[model samples]
Target: MLRRTGIPLLALAVFAGPALAGCGGGEPEESAADLLSRAKTTLDDASSAHFVLDSEGAPNSGTLLVGGEGDIARPASFEGTLNVRALGSTLDLEVVSVDGTVYAQLPFASGFSVVDPAQFGFGDPGALLDPDTGISQLLAEAENAELGEERRVDGDVVREVTAELPGDLVEQILASQDPSQAVQARFSIATETGELRRAELTGPFFTAEDDATYTVELSDFGADVEITAPPTG
Candidate 1:
């Protein structure tokens, strides 16, 4: 079983005030919005990063192993396991989204298949952090943004921020609500490096469930990221 995400998944403390600079960076004081915008720019310009998305106990779940690790990159594709809790089974699923198309190795299959990620509860995981309409856009459109206190996350001290996300992005990425429904979002960034560490969205995504939290953690920024369709026999 995958390890739990730990206690850092607290609801980001949202204070009603101007943003503040992160905990340690010896830089000009910046509001939560400024910091987020800067970080978004940094990530948008990067080629790739090792990513791990954990949504167990969430409305949707899944994955794969690279040397026994679940590592995926952005801008085009993701390879990992797809967790099916209802059936208590997991499938090796790889997804690629580029040029308005999605390719994948569906569960219980070996060859690459053209598929839609929306069927898996995500419109497109590859674009979840898109420079334009993904997290970058959300941060740019964030409102009531506030910087929270610094805290340790997975052993590293990170600066936290909480804000309200645009309704459209919430519907697109989390999809826990109707397009018109609004939601809150929180993010943590490395104080020293301004790197985004974690993102949490709290809202309703599943049927009959009032509200659920989906957390996505990112690491290994700027690692080699290469994606290609599976080989045809």
Candidate 2:
């Protein structure tokens, strides 16, 4: 009788183990809004970061930004190269911004020259990390945000959040041809660190007739970076 009772108890324990594991014994999953809030805070607290911006389907004839990669420091400072489509060709311009003034080494130019950022169809890349006017604003203003799949990015687990953004707000961060049209955005935030890993935007950014997609990747948060104005001749 003792042996028979022990067998039954062992069977019960084996069955219960799988049930407990299936019930998700870990912490509860975070809501989409809560995750975005945490990501915003993470970026807001970061002093500097590295970024890569790439766009697709942009018109070839206009003075529009095609791609860029560089480092940005807090309180408005940036150093990087920008790919701009102008005069029917793409020009890679070396740019540096400090305190609202933009300096660029124009193609075939001898030295850096002060120029208007708007001429290239985008504003100060340095402002991309601003807590109030930059990426944080998009997180706070996202409408109907919904959590999507989780995936590994650069060896880190990230969660995707899908949402719609106001076109005017997007226009402020990047350039847009139609500020009245809404833009779709997908944000990938690191699950462990709550840091924004990537942002994908799709909308009529270059022209009202065609839609363009821009992918921005952020990393190296809180990096010790210092940017200064280039010597202009």
Candidate No. with top lDDT: 2
Alpha carbon lDDT of each predicted model: 0.63, 0.92
Q: Which parts of model 2 have CA positions greater than 4 angstroms off? A: 1-25
Cα error, candidate 2, residue 94 (Å): 0.5
Tens digit per residue, CA lDDT, model 2, 1-233: 99989998999999998998888777788999999999999999999999999999987687999899999889888999998999889889999999889999988899999999998888988787888788788898999999999999999999999999999999999978899999999999999999999999999999987889999999999999999898999
Lowest-sum lDDT 10-residue window in model 2: 126-135
Per-residue lDDT of 182 in model 1: 62
* Model 1 C-alpha RMSD to native: 15.5
Question: Candidate 1 regions off by >4 Å?
Answer: 1-28, 56-75, 84-92
TM for every model, in the order presented, reads: 0.73, 0.91
**Global CA lDDT computed for model 1:** 0.63
Give the best candidate by TM-score.
2
Model 1 — which ten-residue stretch has the worst lDDT? 60-69
